[model samples]
Target: MEKFAMKKTLIALAALAATTAFAQSTATISGSINVGIMNTGASGAQTEVASLGGGANAININVAEDLGGGLRGGFDSQIRFNAANGDRNSAGAVNALFHTANTYLTGGFGTARIGSIVEAGTCAFDPWGCTGGAALQAGTGISALGGAASVKQAVQYTTPTVNGFSANYTSSLSARTNERQTLGVNYANGPLALTAINIKGSGNSTTDGGTAITDTATSQRAIGASYDFGVARLSFLNTVNKGVGGATTADFTSIGATVPMGAYTLLAGFNKNDRATANFDTKISVGVNYALSKRTTLGADLFRSEELAAIAPRTGTAGSGFVTRIRHTF
Candidate 1:
């Protein structure tokens, strides 16, 4: 009798625990992996073709608890790993190392997290899909100006939206150490959306051995917008960065459109990057994605970039590449 009662008690406790967990307002686990093969070709005598492997993987866990009185708090973390080489790289190092990648937090006025996190300027445009790609430094552009491969230590906050408008701000604590401050505002209504971000970095003055003083201070401003036209969506983005110390300034402008047909979507974009003074570089990409199922997609993209200049002669510079990928979500 005693043993049977003990077994029943344990079962009851397990059921209660499950009930408590389900009663919580929030908790979730999500992840995705994308793998693909790429063929690349460059101008001039450069190898015309080569096969390469590429992929991105990410896993995220989020938990939230209600604090009562219309206040709630939560924590979110993500681990991004490269399955190809079993390498983990980000703000933290091996496992989202840097302070901005894997963050822990608690809050009420909103929420605060410590670890690898994007600046407010980068996050403000999340809903409009401006938050990804090489242009956004989350992916895509190889030399994307914003985040790219750099990480920042920051504190950020987002204000509660009022009338379809929201704003955010992020500030860095350390000066001259990738320290950046940003402000952004977003508005969305019906089929139209707009986002604007401004970023400023404190110039670093320290250099190895002090042979020459280097100014690292720079500023960037960008605006992006998109409109849905039933069968297709049209988007435009423009960014300008002013370098310190008479260095060449850079500007990037992009325009693109996406059209949906049946189970496939076609996308095309043209971008121009003005390095120094004139239009020195330009890129064009076209992509098609076919949904094989609700959670699986097959896609291919072709991209080309060219350098136009007299001194460099644009030799050994122009390049073309194609990528075929399979992506699955779980």
Candidate 2:
């Protein structure tokens, strides 16, 4: 029965791609699934879990059509699933099959992207996000609680780079809950890149579940830069998250480097989260990857995190994590 179900899912995916690309000028299917053993907080005083946890697996389909006059249109859709059980990733109250979806148009006026789109301030420079290694926490310090990288009902625009500089803006076009807006500007030339991002959301005016609430404005502003030397690349990012309604604010700083060592590459990263509570948390990650081919790799990362400020209400703790996996891409 399990094999039958898996076969049906594959058939459905192929059919969907066919229908989407029936009349498009160009279409492609690209995705990867990494399967490996993962252990988190196994012997620590905190929680414990042992399962098949690797980087998120996805099936992506993209189609594009040239509309002439220096204009083009395309649509991209992605399905994220757990490699362990083949279950979809649930966000908010919905278990969406299409985790990432966007339709875009490009021309002389730059590019306009609509629908569920990538947030403006999320990882434009992170080598991990752009394909480096399989360190599950690739974007750990970028968003709140490692939330989704894309938002719904989002519309965004990117300006054409005149001299290696560009700007972009995005906003959730919804007013029912809270208004969210993001802005980013970046400069990239040669082996250097710099980016600044600001994300703000209007707070709620009413209370829910009998909790009184005030203030509807919260924000997270960050700046990041990176330089690549022939031997190794270094990057740094600092983020300040203004808590909800004058609560506790936090400043998160992350630094990472990727060094190429012949057929093997070394990756190291350090993250510090300083909260208004005076106590803080620090995490260090290091890993090495061996390239089996141009598109395949075998890698393992070791991570340890400690909290001086209580992770629980008033208790500080330490945790360890390890994952080794084989990742392939097309």
Candidate 3:
């Protein structure tokens, strides 16, 4: 009789403890590995498969804790690696073990994150994320400006969506020469999303054994929009960069489209940069993607880039090449 009473008491205590929990926590691991061979430069090209962040190879660690009442805290860290050799990325290149790590908090109002965040102003009108061979970056005529691969030691905030409208702001705490402060506003309604952004930064050449000097400020203003029509989506982007030293005023434009057909996707985009004192260039790329599964993709692309006589890097350089790629995620 005494043992029976003790067992009942232990069960009651266990049930009470279960009902009094104040928070919940979760951790998830997700990553992708992309392998491809392509000629990304204008010179001699080689077919190598070890491209980290060249297209899509990344690992992400996400952890979150629910603090109840629609508030949560989390941390996110994404690292880039080469699939061929397993080397990590640093300084946008595969060198170290980690790349970007940040923390975030979400509440009824919105979500905010800091530490190595992505640039917010460059993807307003890109269908292919403004990257890869079939995106704006593959085009020569478009000189994309004021987009950081990732911001370090930064503080960022985003407002909750209200009727498909949201706002975002980011400022870097790093006291570098070209630290950026960015502001962006976004609106999404059904298949249409629009964006407006402003970027301001100041930097000058350092002299006398890394001594700081003053230089003119660089500013960028941009607006872009995209619409999806089920079968295909169209995108347009434009930007103006001012105070770029010798170039002075530079203007850029890009337009692209993506079409979905069963398990395949068609990608196309064009980019151009126009600066009076500099050389003119234009880039065009077309690609196709085959989705093997929800987390696996296979694709190929062909790019044709042209440059004028004045520029040293691409001057009188015109070439076309192809790349085949595969991506798998877990």
Candidate 4:
């Protein structure tokens, strides 16, 4: 009888341990669906949908394990699709089902993440939140150097906040000689936030035979700031891109403000890009958003642009456009 009771107790303890281990891990699915009707001088009126903060449909899978000693391991994957046609991507290199897949570890040492990850600090100063047709970062070509939205095969590290200041670094693991490196520093306290970012890489300038040339280094530097004062929030950003031999290729500046009134928020912004050879681009945007619920929003925006010197590609000509969108998060 003693032996039988001892064996049963051991089995019960093992069962409890297994249950505890399972309880320490968690998995969740969450994301958003955003769709809109857009009209532009370049691409007329059309139904469109895309991803987070960019009018796309996406599903996110997140899993986390509580590793003891105040450490945790996590995985995040985002699957973006076109709500209009159920396509992986309308047009881009990110045609795969999973455009964003990252593994991260967090503890007292801050956070370290690797894999194909979403680019950080892309929409810090855009009042439109980088959404729809009037998105400054997307349309005005402010973040053209790094392609604005995504980074692949990269490693990222972020430091813990110390006195409302933190630093982040990310580098691509591409085999190319001009692998990109990005460094950013951010600070936030009370209603004011500030950020500075630098991206450095060698241009893929090659000879006629496609031999890689590393003689010239190109870089982009940006500074952004925002302040919230109860009813209104205002933001500003300045970015400069330097080409080979350190010649300034593009200089972009933007300023925007948002005012909230109960469930309605109003936005307005203007931006300009001054490029080399007298080529320049400018835009003015205004919009409003209404909160249908905590998780749903309806918004509309109107924007006008002048693409002098054809700095960036526009639809037909520099003109005006509008977008109406509905978005829901879960």
Candidate maximizing TM-score = 4
Give the Cα lDDT of each candidate: 0.56, 0.63, 0.67, 0.71
> 1 or 2: which has the higher TM-score?
2
Cα error of candidate 3 at position 24, Å: 2.9
Q: What digit string (tens of lDDT, one per residue) describes model 2 on residues 1-330?
A: 999999999999998887666545889998786655554432433322222222246678898887766788999887766665677742223556675689999889999999876665435444454322223224221222222245667798999997999998887787635566778888999999998888777421212111111225777777888999989998887877776675547677777788999989998777777773333367677878899998788777776655422445654455566657667776
Residue 249: error of model 1 in Å? 1.8
Please give the lDDT score for candidate 2: 0.63
lDDT of 4 at 21: 84
Candidate 3 Cα lDDT to native = 0.67
Residue-level lDDT for 173 in candidate 3: 77
TM-score of each: 0.73, 0.78, 0.81, 0.82
Please, what are the lDDT tens digits per residue for candidate 3 over residues 8-57?
Answer: 99999987776455355789989877677776545555656635233256
Best by lDDT: 4
* Cα RMSD of predicted structure 2: 11.4
Alpha carbon lDDT of residue 48, candidate 3? 67
Show model 1 residue runs off by greater than 4 Å.
1-26, 43-56, 92-114, 120-152, 175-178, 202-215, 246-248, 276-280, 307-317
Return whichever of 3 and 4 wins on lDDT. 4
List ranges where model 3 is wrong by over 4 Å: 1-20, 50-55, 92-96, 138-148, 177-179, 202-216, 244-249, 276-279, 307-315
Which 10 residues in a row give candidate 4 its minimum summed lDDT? 204-213
- The candidates, ranked best first by TM-score, are 4, 3, 2, 1
What are the RMSD figures for all models against the true structure? 7.2, 11.4, 5.3, 5.3
